[model samples]
Target: MATSTLLLHPVRLRIVQSMLGHAQTTTRELAERLGDVAPATLYRHVAALVDGGVIEVVSETRVRGASERSLRLNLSRASVDPDDEALVDDERVRAGFLAYLASLASAFDDYLAAPRSTLEADLVGFRQVAVFATDDEWREVAATIRDALLPLIERSERPEGARRRILGTVSLPVD
Candidate 1:
């Protein structure tokens, strides 16, 4: 049972989060979406993800005379457990969590920067928050949230039109 926090360093976290829900991405696509991450730096992070078994090479295609590599995550095995808790305490994990969050923020910021008009309903994002009861309350709330979002993902696996690639992360805070 691998701990997600042990697996998710700042750079590795960004790469995994970005690659989630997408069909596949080449090293170049990842570098571009990640922003300001030099290819060498991004490649190192990507390699780490590959080594961790969080992300795996899915396809090879030719682009500009180069063999472009595509990678995707192994969803069934992707999770953080108590043993996966790499931090000494809540404070340390929070710091890494904040850094992990900022990368997600940057990804969305870059998305909004794309050439598109606000009239497009598909080109939008939103957030919601709720306070819970006991630790069990928090756990149930988290499970409910995952339930709500998972249908769309399962739908994407069916033979359908081109699926829209997206990334998602759920934060379940506990003390």
Candidate 2:
């Protein structure tokens, strides 16, 4: 399967998102985190990702009589490179982008559906920013973001009262 195809799937995208910032995650843990997805379906998507090289099984151990696997995402394979001619099928890529947006919408809807959702108190936010900058300026801004966020990304300890939040970034030129 194409990387874009594998990565942009709604369920698969959620699986990837759950694995982000962690060095490794177990199949059991994924099953628990994405409880809405059936174990069979989740296992299928995980196998597909493993086959596509989007994720790798780093270790395996037996829990009871069953085999348990520890997996990690290959971040390099988690996105589409439009410049890579071999991977660019215009329609597929566009569809994948739409699926990506749909996943974000679904996440927000889930949040709203939660009984105790308090957007302001929860610090939930989504917005669009339009920037006019030369390529170098844009690179600098991106670099700044990376530098500032990298530490948090690398932290393995979950401090008290620090709830997990998802952050998504999209940049596109205005035509």
What is every candidate's alpha-carbon RMSD to the true fold? Answer: 3.8, 2.5
Q: Which candidate is the best by lDDT?
A: 2
* lDDT at 112, model 1: 77
The 0-to-1 C-alpha lDDT of every candidate, in the order given, reads 0.70, 0.83
Off by over 4 Å in 2: 115-117
- Candidate 1 structure quality by residue, lDDT tens digits, 97-170: 77677877876677777866673555466666756578787789779987987887655564655545455556
Candidate maximizing TM-score: 2
Instruction: For candidate 1, list the clashing residue pairs, or say none.
Output: 3-84
Off by over 4 Å in 1: 1-7, 61-66, 89-92, 116-132, 157-175
Count steric clashes of candidate 2: 0
Minimum summed lDDT over a 10-residue window in model 1 is located at: 1-10
What TM-score does each of the candidates earn? 0.72, 0.81
